[model samples]
Target: MARHLRAFLGADDATLARRLTAAGTVQAVLDAIRTRLSEPARDALVAELTAATGGLLEEDLDSILLSGLLGYHGLVDAARQTAAEQDMTNLVTLDHHLVRVTSEPVVEVLVDRQQAYELRLALTVTFTVQGLAATVRAGRLVHVRIGRCSADVSLSWAGQALVRHSDLVDAPLVIKLGSGVPVHEITDPADDPALARGTARVPGPRVAQPGS
Candidate 1:
């Protein structure tokens, strides 16, 4: 389920909603069956679930969330860049801890050759990273690591049904850290001098830029 979700991260609004619904449906059935089984029987199904997901059920939650966050950032950067070139407003915010990101995309579409209306869309992805840790340098957060993660996703399109999920449900999942995974760099020291010194370790969550 995590593997499919990772692919859906970069998909269009409609496609994402469709896939999430499908995955959620499958997960519901699997969950019902597992709950009725004995403890040992339930435990044995772990291997089956792993096989069914091609091992993605056991994949690192940190890596999946990081990829999604990075992709989210890239989208925001692209949108802002385009807005700057076109002299338009781009309303996008990623929180300081990088745990939540919201984007409001406003585009003008012509109803005919003579009239047009602005179409506004919204998307938000929020994550709660359990046991999150941080590295601070020069008064700025520079790196992070995670123990586990759960997510909330919502996407809305003008004149269309809204899609939201507290977590992906295709199968019962336990999101945890992968062995030997390294801390992720959230900021580059070379990009900002303030991020280069005064190193300290701390605990926290992550994502955002000022005036953006």
Candidate 2:
């Protein structure tokens, strides 16, 4: 009877025949069937089979085997959805109208010993207005701004503060300038010890000898 149902569900004909021919394969076939069914269907089938057989079984049984298969399917679907969302979120359209200038050899400066020097950098940015208006370039500087700094600096694009720099002198003297852009300038003082640790340090205040 189960063999007929297995055939109706498209189970391989040879495999079904082999299972039906062996008494030891019956339990294995039943386990395989339960794993392929969804939760509701599995429950319904289990109820029908148990009632028909009058609750005769030789070992403990659990729904976990079926539930695990469904769980595996659910996980696969969730992973696909997350990957799709990530792809959509990361999609960026390039703007082909802006000219960008990047300066290399990011400058490092030290202000003084014990106190780190803080600098406010200002960039005189020039854009080829003609290129942007015509969309002739492959890159666009959609916006320009300064990141955090230890000291405050007044910024102007033709006199406007696109971005403000703050917190330059804080601990961890290193500062990251901007996101997805290059830094134009970094200012540091000449007397910084971290910058000149290899140089000799001047002697501290000397006390006159009592004998002298």
Candidate 3:
């Protein structure tokens, strides 16, 4: 499952393995996914949304909100699919200490493949669920109320990934939702209209980011 997700996000397994204890693991993961995008894919995505909405949101704020909605859905879907593919019979307990990931992903298979990574099954893959909205400036924002989220997750696992999270090539124009952001913001790192069209930047990791 980890391998497939890395493939989906275009993350290099070797790099991830090496960074298992590094501070920049999350940033590195996001960059890997972000840098993979091509300009053309970004353009088409926005065009499709524009057509779907009958050009209702021609304004930048509206456009970004639309993008956030699309991006949020894509994130949730991919997370769910990835969660489903894993075999987690051995995931005995889901205590935080057993599965800590300050940045890098730790795929500690230990000597017990049968019981190792046992928490995968019991742990639900969650994202923002409701009370969600978006804001636009230089990029985008999927806003969550202070101390709250659409996913409504408890304080324990917010912002940090249960495992690994990364960006991809030919990906959407997303900005990092950096620490203390209080929302799932997918910003356009660069203000390129072409980014609006990258429909490939969705569930299952942006159409596999080219060499998926």
* TM-score leader: 1
Ten residues in sequence with the least summed lDDT for candidate 1: 196-205
Off by over 4 Å in 3: 1-70, 73-107, 111-122, 146-212
In model 1, how large is the Cα lDDT of residue 30? 36
- Tens-place lDDT digits, model 2, residues 1-212: 11121122222434323322233322332453333444554344333322221111111111111111122222234334444453321212222222222111111112122212111222221122111111101121112221211222221222333222322222222212122111111112112333212211112223469998
Model 1 clashing residue pairs (backbone): 27-170, 97-206, 97-207, 98-206, 98-207, 99-206, 138-197
lDDT of 3 by residue, 1-212 (tens): 11122232222433333333243433332343453434563333223322322111122322233334444443344334434554311111111111111111121111111211211111111232222222322222323222122111111112443233332211122333432132234343124433211121211124546666
Give stretches of model 2 more than 4 Å off.
1-96, 100-113, 129-212
- TM-score sort, best first: 1, 3, 2
Candidate 2 colliding pairs: 149-166, 149-167, 149-168, 150-167, 150-168, 150-169, 156-160, 157-160
Work out candidate 3's RMSD over C-alphas.
21.9
Q: Against the hidden true structure, what lDDT does model 2 obtain?
A: 0.24
Q: What TM-score does candidate 3 get on C-alpha atoms?
A: 0.18
Model 1: residues with Cα > 4 Å off, grouped in runs:
1-6, 9-98, 111-115, 158-161, 165-212
